[model samples]
Target: MVKFGYTILYVEDVEKSIEFYENAFGFARKFVSPENDYGELNTGGTTLSFASKNLGVQNLEDGFIESTLEDKPFAIELAFVTDDVGDLVQKATSLGAVLVAEPKKKPWGQVVSYVRDLDGFLIEICTPVEM
Candidate 1:
């Protein structure tokens, strides 16, 4: 059966990205490869992983492109659920994540905000849905 798994982000430094998630969002580190080119984090039901840019290049013949500090984030985004969007925004920003949008209340009564991770990956922090 097909099921959703983890998302892997290509980064310059896997260890630093791993630390960023740990300090910014409180995700505990799962492990890092012995080669120091890959790392994973315990993000509840699904994992969040990071791979070195070199690894990405080695894996893809055409070489995959990724968001850069000089470029805008990719179209897709990773959404994180939290009770306090403001607090998480502060934490993410303090860890070098640039704020894309400020927290705002949606018509459905949910608060949501957007930010870009150190690698320019889009991230959304919002209150947990009661459904």
Candidate 2:
């Protein structure tokens, strides 16, 4: 059997990326490599991980397009569900996250907003979707 495990974002600074998530979203740090080139966050069921761009380059023979705040965000996004969408969005922005959209109530009864992390990755902050 196979299962989804974690998502790793290649960042310029592993430590700072992990720190940002910890400060902005309150995820606890799980571990960091001795070289500080990689780290993981204890994000419940699926871990959220970060690796330095150098590490990513070492792993992938072909270089990849790095995310940057000056560019448009990638198509995919990491969504965090919270009871208070507005507050979390505000907190994230205060911690250097770029606000992409303000919280709005969806037709499905979910309040959702968007932000770009320090790495310029799109993040969706929202209330849990009712099934």
Candidate 3:
């Protein structure tokens, strides 16, 4: 059986991506390069890494690749769970994240919202309602 441990994302600016994740999603940096070409972020139980395309070859299987004849940006969606969806939404919006959805109670007993990161990756912040 394969267990998922972490996810990696490719960005135009690793430093800016790191800062956005840290401020918007409350992730802390595990390590960062002086050149800002790459960095790792710790999200409680998992780690997310950011890399710049100009730095070197990226492992394509990580799922952040976008193919275009010209250099076009590509991004993926990542979900985060929180106890207070409203607060997280407010924090993310304040941090310059584009709000895609507002906090709303869902039928699955979850209050959720969606936001786009600096790199245009979608993120879902949610709180599971008690059944």
Top TM-score model: 2
For model 2 the local lDDT of residue 110 reads 98
The lDDT of model 2 is: 0.95
Mark the 10 consecutive residues where model 1 has the least summed lDDT: 65-74
Best by lDDT: 2
Per-residue lDDT tens digits of candidate 1, residues 1-131? 98667899999899999999999999999999999899999998888999999999998879998778789788899999999999999999998999999999998889999999989999999998766
TM-score of each: 0.96, 0.98, 0.79
Clashes of 1: 0
Each model's number of backbone clashes? 0, 0, 0
Model 3 pairs in collision: none
Q: Which sections of candidate 3 miss by over 4 Å?
A: 56-76, 129-131
Could you give me the TM-score of model 3 versus the true structure?
0.79
**Alpha-carbon lDDT, every model:** 0.93, 0.95, 0.77
Better of 2 and 3 by lDDT: 2
List candidate 1 stretches off by more than 4 Å.
none
Error of 2 at 106 (Å): 0.7
lDDT for 40 in candidate 2 is 97
Tens digits of per-residue lDDT, candidate 2, 24-87, equal: 9999999999999999999999999999999999999899999999999989999999999999
